[model samples]
Target: MFLGKVVGSVWATQKEVGMEHLKLLLVQPIHADGTDAGTQVICADRIGAGQGETVIVSRGSSARILISKDSPVDAVVVGIVDSFEYCKE
Candidate 1:
């Protein structure tokens, strides 16, 4: 999983049947301190996250399985991070 910020939403009136009901969001990866990590990704939002919210994104093949038993999603927003904790050495 990765930490990211929900930047915007995507709207499509017509799409594949399996992807029709899911909400899509443009997410940019971010550091724990809330700084941009210079990478942007579009993911299916399973948790209803909004813009500016810190979210947790599941990636790769497992991401799809996590959202649904039979989905083709490559990435998905699984949770919203209310607070972050990291041990700095």
Candidate 2:
């Protein structure tokens, strides 16, 4: 898993059979210090995360199995971070 910020939402007019109940968000990967680390990614959200919220993301097969066995999801929002203290050393 990794840290990220929910930058936006992805809306699809039509979705796959098991995906209709999920919401997608555009997440910008962030470092532990909360700075952008890489390109944005569309992530499956099941915990109602919103824009600008700090979130924890899990990727690949582990994430896919959590949502569905046959989902095409490569990334998913696992948690909404409540708060954190960054101590840069």
Candidate 3:
């Protein structure tokens, strides 16, 4: 899992099998200190996360747990962050 901020959204007119209902989002990888960690990633969301929200992302097989164990999703939003604390000093 990783911390990320939703940067934008993605619209795909043509859907792959089992991917029709998933909402895709563009997320900028972030560290606990609210700084960029890596390149942005496109994630699949089912819990209604919008732009600028901080979300917890699950990757690989863990991402498929909520939908299906065989889902082809590479990333999924697991939690919508309400509040968090971080310090790097």
Candidate 1 lDDT for residue 34: 77
| Residue runs of model 3 more than 4 Å from their true location after superposition | none
Give the number of the best model, judged by TM-score: 2
Candidate 3 lDDT over 1-89, as tens digits, reads 99999999999998777889999999999999898999999999999999999999999888877777777889999899999988667
Per-candidate Cα lDDT values, in order, are: 0.86, 0.94, 0.92
What is the per-residue lDDT of model 1 for residues 1-89, given as tens digits with 9 covering 90 to 100? Answer: 88999999888898665787889999999987778987799899867899999999988887877766577778899899888787767
For candidate 2, the lDDT comes to 0.94
Q: Which stretches of candidate 2 lie over 4 Å from their true place?
A: none
Candidate 2's residue-wise lDDT over 1-89, tens digit each? 99999999999979987898889999999998888899999999989999999999999999999999999888999999999888888
Per-residue error for 68 in candidate 2, Å, reads: 0.9
In model 2, residue pairs whose N, Cα or C atoms come closer than 3 Å (at least 3 residues apart or on different chains), thus clashing, are none
